[model samples]
Target chain A: MQAGKPILYSYFRSSCSWRVRIALALKSIDYEMVTVNLIKDGGQQFSEEFQALNPMKQVPALKIDGITIGQSLAIIEYLEETRPTPRLLPQDPKKRAHVRMISDLIASGIQPLQNLSVLKQVGQEKQLSWAQQVISSGFNALERILQSTAGKYCVGDEVSMADLCLVPQVANADRYKVDLTPYPTISRINKSLLTLEAFQVSHPCRQPDTPPELRA
Target chain B: MQAGKPILYSYFRSSCSWRVRIALALKSIDYEMVTVNLIKDGGQQFSEEFQALNPMKQVPALKIDGITIGQSLAIIEYLEETRPTPRLLPQDPKKRAHVRMISDLIASGIQPLQNLSVLKQVGQEKQLSWAQQVISSGFNALERILQSTAGKYCVGDEVSMADLCLVPQVANADRYKVDLTPYPTISRINKSLLTLEAFQVSHPCRQPDTPPELRA
Candidate 1:
């Protein structure tokens, strides 16, 4: 990154941002952190400057070597591609598909349903418990898939892209009071992953921009 | 396809299932459509047999060449990897990541929030308008993304995985009465994509498995 380190526009509690953070750290790529508080004065992400960076006005947008990118799964894949030294995806096509599948399972299926914005919407018009129930069902489904597919990580023994996606969502789920017992495999994988330096350094609680109220 | 074509466990109205169907048709790979009704008898997708194939018990599960894969994004990607003749993803990593980002924006970001399950949760407990608002806001964000990035297709000229994801989700947004006028780019892209043989043939209304009552 001769042009300079990638700049990540992120918020501490944003699971999507956390996924990208883990990926950058895993690849050992140097990058500057640009905090975008999601809850301050109607979201810093919606600021004109940030919106230009990500028109979607969401966290986890990256400006890498002058090019800006968004979406956690895509950002992680980009890192895996550009920094191929310590690979985050398997080389085999089938294995790569499996890895992508696990990542999508979380990125597409589970995480979105329980995102902060969605829950805020639920709380406004629907009941908080109702949103939690919807989130729990998503988690239950995730746990079931992880049971057969996971081994130390989301896909297999390797620390693939799936694990990066999995850990943060699991962290968010626990905060919502989700029971981890039903998803033993997911819980086990989370346990193994939390021990790693990549995940440890990327924890939301450690972020400089995390809200004081939510800090553990 | 030696085992009498792959069995696609799908729901006619499912956007996720529709994605895989389009991919299958694009490749000219034949598949047996096995309807798993999402609304009948508390969702047939939750049945023991279906759960055996997909622990998540969601439609658009593919039983391909002896192996079953769940999640539409995963299934389409698996096909892309396994059969590379007509590539769905670009060769360049940055471009591939761009395609995946657009796809992920729909798959993970937009589609999940407005799923039938989510709406059902809202209807079962909350007001109808509440659900519509959630769907509308998500679509609005999507429209913003489409406005800047989309060309004749989602990511410039080619028909890629993002197009497959875009059409189906747009269909769902229409079902919820979300207006298309605000999203001119999305509407324009949808119009062009609709003309394609793959999208036309794979349309839910054109599907043989679609119940007469649900046919548009």
Candidate 2:
């Protein structure tokens, strides 16, 4: 085992990073946070040091067990494997599949289309509309799925990884001014998830590198 | 367990669907293929029946163990959990993290950006260039990560989930005419993976729904 606290390289406003942050908090893993300011200095993630750590040049990359792991879901799954308490994935195989399906719908289907890098490629003039359309379309599908799957949280009331992904994407939807009126289930779950200490403490607004003006 | 063979709802040309197909083949799972042609009839995935199976309206939803699961990675993970033979994930924690990281980099970071839906939204004229650029950028990082992690396959000699994600994506990159010269590692791995029986049988050109003119 690694001697020191695991290091989490994160950006304050990145939804992907926020997902990892919530997982770390939920599992009660003590770790160090190093800010990789995605916007400042033309993205610290592109720097030689950070690039060496994570060739993908994205945050939240975690250093633990003497290895550095990139990709938020991968890192979280590692934690789930090693830690396994206050479990982020459901125990039942089918319930676990629901958690993963919901998580991937947001992570792959929704978030990637509207991320900072993709937005930059989308160009300044069309970014907002592009993000809004992507989020709305994804949420349309998500709302229908959640209507069937949700109880108190995504996948039958368990605070699974699906909830971890849900809250952050809802925050992004809010940022993009997506009309949540059509997604009552999503809105309700986001509201319910926000009340938890793990979610509140690990929120983007509460992060160490969150801009002073944006801090909660 | 379900009495009959598990059903895989798939489109022949979809990279995401191809990932699941490769996994199902690798596990030697007996499955029924139900075609959901994305192009014909304005996307069969949009029909009420398909939407009920997968609200995300994406192909490669799997019906197994009496539950329907969507998202390629989710379905693959469920398969790994249940079957566990000829494992898609490594036994070691760190190695598994490596496999998952590479898989997510392709699945979330790359495939989603250049998917049929995103390309349609990108508009007809710019689709080729948009896909080329996205695939090239993502492959740059993937090549670097693979250089470090690869043995006979991504994360080691084992044909892990990372390989399942890689072959389909490299096929996508080829479809967009992205130059593979800069990514020798990826090119070599793709060449090697193509020799495998599972990859061969699961290929897009070999799919049941593949157009007659496109069939291998």
Please give, for residues A64-111, the per-residue lDDT of candidate 2 as tens digits: 999999999999899999999999998998899999999999999999
Candidate 1 chain B: 10-residue stretch with minimal lDDT: B122-131
TM-score of 1: 0.93
Docking class of 2: high
lDDT of all predictions? 0.81, 0.93
lDDT of 2 by residue, B80-112 (tens): 999989899999999999999999999999999
Candidate 2 displacement at residue B36 in angstroms: 1.1
For candidate 1, give the lDDT of residue B36.
88
Deviation in Å, model 1, residue A137 alpha carbon: 1.9
Task: Please give the C-alpha DockQ score of model 1.
Answer: 0.62
- Candidate with maximal DockQ: 2
| Candidate 2 stretches greater than 4 Å from native | none
